[model samples]
Target chain A: MTLTTLPPPHHEPVAPHDLRARVTDVLLRFIDDQDQILRDVDPELSTMTTALREFVLSSGKRLRSTFCYWGWRGAGGAPDDEGILVAASALELLQGCALIHDDVMDSSDTRRGLPTMHRRFARWHRLGDLHGSPEEFGTSVAILLGDLCLSWCAQMFDGCGLSEAAISRAKPAFHQMHTELMAGQYLDLLGPARGGGSSERARLIIDYKTARYTVGRPLELGALLADGGPELRARYAAYARPLGEAFQLRDDVLGVFGDTERTGKPAGDDLRAGKHTVMMDLTRSRATAAQRAVLDALFGNPDLDRDGIGKIQDIIRETGALASVNALIEEHRTAALSHLTDSLLETETQATLTELAITVTNRDY
Target chain B: MTLTTLPPPHHEPVAPHDLRARVTDVLLRFIDDQDQILRDVDPELSTMTTALREFVLSSGKRLRSTFCYWGWRGAGGAPDDEGILVAASALELLQGCALIHDDVMDSSDTRRGLPTMHRRFARWHRLGDLHGSPEEFGTSVAILLGDLCLSWCAQMFDGCGLSEAAISRAKPAFHQMHTELMAGQYLDLLGPARGGGSSERARLIIDYKTARYTVGRPLELGALLADGGPELRARYAAYARPLGEAFQLRDDVLGVFGDTERTGKPAGDDLRAGKHTVMMDLTRSRATAAQRAVLDALFGNPDLDRDGIGKIQDIIRETGALASVNALIEEHRTAALSHLTDSLLETETQATLTELAITVTNRDY
Candidate 1:
């Protein structure tokens, strides 16, 4: 053996683009395997499998998986571990399940500047000139597809080629992640049913539905996989929780005010859908009687025109709800980023995490 | 040490009622644990948890769990094992998920003589005079509850306290069961979307949607848990596959002709839903031109009245389709039962399985 070349000191910090590409590659191979399973059962499932591949591989920031990757790295895991990549990729499949079902419940027509899952299938029904109501067909297909994603998530995790003990160690967090997310979804349904929920209720929803599910659990999952000690696990949570809150707050702002082209969702869409976001709750709490009246008339009106939306927008800003939300977001971002500055984690990991926090919380979409 | 009558010489052969009671006991305990998890998160979730408890505990024949138990017994697993009971009971939760989603997709009004999951929630919304469309609220709740059941199924299975190796061995079958069932559902959806399907298509649907999932996989799971050899596993599949098909055929017969009081569904419910059942396909294929005219007019009519149903029923009999289906059921039942006799299984196990096969296939409901 010649000493012609020496191994690099450590794997270079995986670039965001490279991380995304690797995740995508794993996801594609996984889906292709699943597609074969479906095909073996029946060729008629080709359409559904094709649609799933597209829905999963198509778009959105791979934030959850990236956070998981970094969490593992921060806990002293090898950057080049293939098993960690496989485990991290499972989150995207779970997210796919959530989004597909979410769109069905919301009756959303579009996502990512294209037809949502149900809408796409509904269009397929119309084009095929198939029997029965196209809308119902779409909804049914979406439900089954969502169920498939959920199943595939478990299958992928178990088949990730990790040691059985390691998989067992991570199982509790995985189970908790699901239960919490579903509970959050259930609470979200309650808001619309019970009518104009309190800001506290909105915050609780944020904790379970968006913050923990979108960020905290993914990080914990990664940390656990690396056999990180309690101290490291606590650090991950402290960094993740506030950052998650900030991320959702940003989403709330984007839902109301961001450009549709950038966000891939209509401006004031949350208001139109009557979503009980914290910002809306704050606006309700702070608005003048006259402003409240305008909100009652214009907010949540499904057919609300530009004038109505503009009026509600004015009320949100005039009552200082928008400013307050922005301030809260900044506070969360600061609290999250402060943990990284004097951390025990490696310098590269800290720098990467910091950049991620800024990019997520400060995004326009 | 007191021998205590030597454990009753092979466990006294658990009676059907006792087996059901035991399964119910385990399920109640599991749900209680899950209920605490929900309550710890939010008190508002109490209603949802309560609903889940009632929906799960109130009804069902517990056939899947029983079959799983017998599968274990036939494979020489310990009759007194609590872990097997836990693993077996997981099937009930899985069934709950499937039925809840099935009801939603079918827009079903009732199940087991009570309002369906969605309808029950919708009615609650109406009674509370809550905001938004009650129908939409109901659908949303059903979807979430269904997802919860799916998650809980996995959770329960993982926590069953079986050896890791045993659980790992059964994992592939458990995963396959879900994927196959979902694909079956997808195929069922395609039937309606593509218009009236052929008899072969209906048989394929039965094989996947009903036969393999409801029988073959559960038996395989139990057998695998016992470390049953390939010969024993093959025998279980042979017994289960045909029995499952017969069970579904019986269900098809009951859907049209069984008493509403016994079946817990409106008479001719499947016809109203336009389900493309094997019997229906047979009827269509065999009907004369004049008979076909009546079949086309009366079959799959949503508002099908007693007289219209009678006309279709008469046509089915006149075409010899009902007789053909009945003969097919007998053929499958005999084929399934033959695997039990002169088998490697214990005599007691053979007898109990024989009883189950007859009861499932011969039931009115």
Candidate 2:
């Protein structure tokens, strides 16, 4: 599955903290350069650069870049390949676009302990005593910023100083990632609209939105950039698929059960939003007729109080749905870890990726 | 200003009709390929492909691509370069992205005599009796579609079958076009929010939104694709700047005064929307106190009547604003044509570009 038989490791695997620092450095430098370009266009345009810089530098897991870097290392790419860092950092920009637009679509007010992009802009509109609806202004500004981030993602990827052949080889994977992300988002919107509450529908959304987009694509992109053969890419996907799903499953668990301060969201936020997660589907299927009435009345009520959330949690636990979901998360995490046991991957890469699988699937936030 | 000396024409200039037909061919083929990709992902996704196909093929002036093609030819590129057609056609997708998002921002119900993308999606939501607000559903779908178009524009441009040198040479123009278009859109939004009615602000918006985006970048992209020297690109920009401004001026005039059937919009659409065009700035500055009072009362009023529109129109005429705008258009048009007289450009290209200048600036819709 590996591209080549490499020499024994001469150095320890890159720590996640080190990888994050490098990614931040690349992003900060790129944003500064863009700030100059936008300033040259007009002084007013500096607002966009400022917003982008703040949102990007504020907070992120940098998980996608970490996985991508390991994918490259696993495929025998040099440890000191600076171009790969730039290429990996592009994913963060794409992630920003997704989060900004997702917040607008969901009417979300906060993220990572601060107001969402649209909400932030709306506050600016109010502060300026600007004409028109502040909410509309905020939505428009967020949309434009999301688009600029998307465009910058491409620009950064192409200008990463990688070899022409490497870039060309990875272009198809990069392009498909964009299309798949949009498609998955569309499906997410469609699911609730179509009254889809089945685990099947929920799983399908997670497959596209999280598993493939967040993990498989980034990993494959790195492998392709390192000129890895198709076999290596398949192995990456095998590991990424279950791990990504587990990552999202953990997120679902946190939405209802995790501490508000740690998760940077209100308790039971998904219940208030009526989000149709797999856990919700499991609960619904397992609920008795009497419990179903409680579910129907309480779930999706924007004004649902703390007491209501407790009742729902009690039902989920009573029916063993919560335990079932926890079991599924553990099962997927184990499956993902099993793929890293293949001998083709370098020993250090295997160890790091194994650690990553545990951390992503077991994190509190 | 052209890059090289060329012999007399072996063929007549490509007529506008022929170029449009060729552009349509490229677009249709690209859409079909994308249709297969989407279908492979999910059958339900066919709705996106169908909507995109209808919007793209139904009606468009193809002005950007026309200017780009001629820019290439003017810089000594062959008329029969199919790859140039692909590069040129990418502009149409970018335009699609702009118009779709513009409609959402404006909350326009119709475009090109048909329901806008959001409206169309809203109707679909209604037909299916879907959950949530249909308006919100429509906005979400439109946003995703717009992002998809923006990504496709870059994908198409890179895969245009051109040599690496040509693609790399044109990449900066392509990158800047995306950034400038978004920045211009932000300024357009900022203008009215800030209550800016100055002609200077209007002209700045036109420079970024229309002049540079619609003409300057496309022309430079074509020239660079042909490997034209800096002199040729600068010459193209000189011609493009004035012509593009005139083109927007003509659009402003049509927005206020053109027949509804020809314009595919309501009567006095710009006035109803409170658009701050250069013509509007001129009208405001020249109005008497009494006329100004009338404008302040009726302009931008969502429910403005025909009588109110007529009064506003009469004041613009009485103040000579309309006539002055027409004069400015002619002056810019003359300047644009003057750039073509340079002996470095081929005779046939010069003639075709001159013809194009008149058509774009004089169109009804």
Candidate 3:
């Protein structure tokens, strides 16, 4: 048989949008499977399964899966590896567990312009006219749902059609990713508990809470699947850690200064929540007497409104902390990209990773 | 090999108290390993780890591990099976995770006469004189700690040194145990939401939430590891389910009628918390119109005090509901013990399981 023709060599690398669509497809299918499984256990749980599907599939970028995909490809993995896609998609459920529980812990009412899980369930408690206090009902539902998601994460990962050898080899990385992320979450809880930590401590939290699992370990998981040696894993981590920090730093900036339309959260929402983000630490350390007075009056104030937020924003700008943070982001972005230079990854994978790096640093949301 | 002496057949079967202490040894060692791992990650997290170890090793009867060990021995597993013990101890950490998060979901202030994880952390927040509301801070800390416990459960299980074949075989059972428990919790949330469910529904909740996982699956996990056949597993489940149901029924009774010193909860704490247990369903169904009205007024009332609790108890006794419940417990207890006959288990192991069945039904706490 004669080949007709070949596609152009200069075609763009795998677009993140396409990757996201595929990952979402895998996730939705998993949710549907879970619905059926849960149905067998109890039909009364159908409402919960429906909410779980919505909470998972309806929102957020599948960023961790993307990192894993590229890392798999970079480690000489095939383009058509469905096992990687399915296994990586489990990360979304893990992320879902984190978000649902995080919202309850933070008492957040909204996420992605929709009511957070606890808020929705709390309202459902009232609307269904269920027994007990609505608030407790909501919190309980979220907790149970979250625990379900976490259990499903392990179930999906083990059942993802990967060879037993591949799964066994990659188990440590997977396990470490979870332990680190949970520790980081604990560190996040400690931020305010420490009564306004030093800036260095804030950065440490970012590294543990956001960096390794969010970026590095996802990549490492992919690499491990392809038998990525220690050298390759280290290289993947080199690119991952700095990039993950940059991502969170940008997120912190957007939390304070980004438009609500793009960010999906109200302006100064993190401040009012007393997030104790690195941005807050940096700005507070740099603020003048007048700026400090403004921060003290308005920051984390429950009654904080547009005008009060505007005052804090104005002070942040005046302190030049905002500009310094941007400068730091640029530094991290450069350091992250620098790791790409010597990596043995394929050209297409490299192109996609480069695209991802840019998207993370520059995104408004 | 020369036999020095013949062992006496008059020796006691697996004493639960002794088994509990041995299981505690395994758990404490595991926690120590985790402490080292976590310490290497962050020294600042010492308090969280300490709390976790204490919360795990300091309390509870190690019932699941005991069930698991005897199940292993009964399935003809070796006496030298450290893997079985290690895998079984993982259940305690899983239980710890469940209790910590469950307390948060319930907004419970105390557990085992100690402040619940959330309450203790909240108090820590206040004591630290840190930022944000102490209540919020405490809740956040508990959520993270619970999440940590959950992740550790998986890690410890996978690292328990069981053969890959054994682990593979047991994975589904372990995963299902988690899913069912969470589903049972969701159903439990529905109980109060349903405004006191039917007796059958309450029993169903107990079966799902407590029985199958707490009693049955631990035994199943042990059997699976031993490569026990379907007949053996079915036998274990038969013995496990009814016993577990009886155990929970006894707990429900103790929640109402047992002494505070023995129960580790205030008298009638379940009534105050609006726990829609089998005891509540049985008692309420048997009440007169005036008693029903009283039940409605007292049950699920946040302000329910000793006086209100006494009234509910009086009605339960007057209507003979308590005696009927005890009869049901006995029925289940007998059904459980009957399954032990004609079993494949070793004589000593069978004896231990029989011993366990009695202790469970008779427990004061």
Q: List the TM-score for candidate 3's chain B.
A: 0.93
Better of 2 and 3 by lDDT: 2
Q: Show where candidate 3 strays beyond 4 Å.
A: A1-15, B1-15
TM-score of chain B of each: 0.94, 0.94, 0.93
Better of 2 and 3 by TM-score: 2
Estimate, for each residue in B1-31, the C-alpha lDDT of model 3 and write its tens digit: 0011213233343455666777788888887
lDDT of 2: 0.85
* Structural similarity to truth (TM-score) of each candidate: 0.94, 0.94, 0.94
Residue lDDT tens for model 1, A1-365: 10112232243333378898899889989988888878887788888889988987776577778888888888888999999999999898889999999999989999888889999999999999999899999999999899888888888888888778878888889988898999999999988789877878888888898778877888888888888888887887888888888888888887887778878887778888788888888899999999989999888888888888889888888888988988899899999988887758888789888887877776552
How many backbone clashes does every candidate have?
A: 0, 0, 0
Model-by-model lDDT, in order? 0.84, 0.85, 0.81
| Interface RMSD of candidate number 3 | 1.1
For model 2, name the residue pairs that clash: none
Q: Estimate the TM-score for candidate 3.
A: 0.94
Across A87-199, the per-residue lDDT of candidate 2 in tens digits comes to: 99998988899999889988899998899999999999999998888999999999999999899898999889898889888888898888889988988898888885567
Question: Which is superior by lDDT, 1 or 3?
Answer: 1
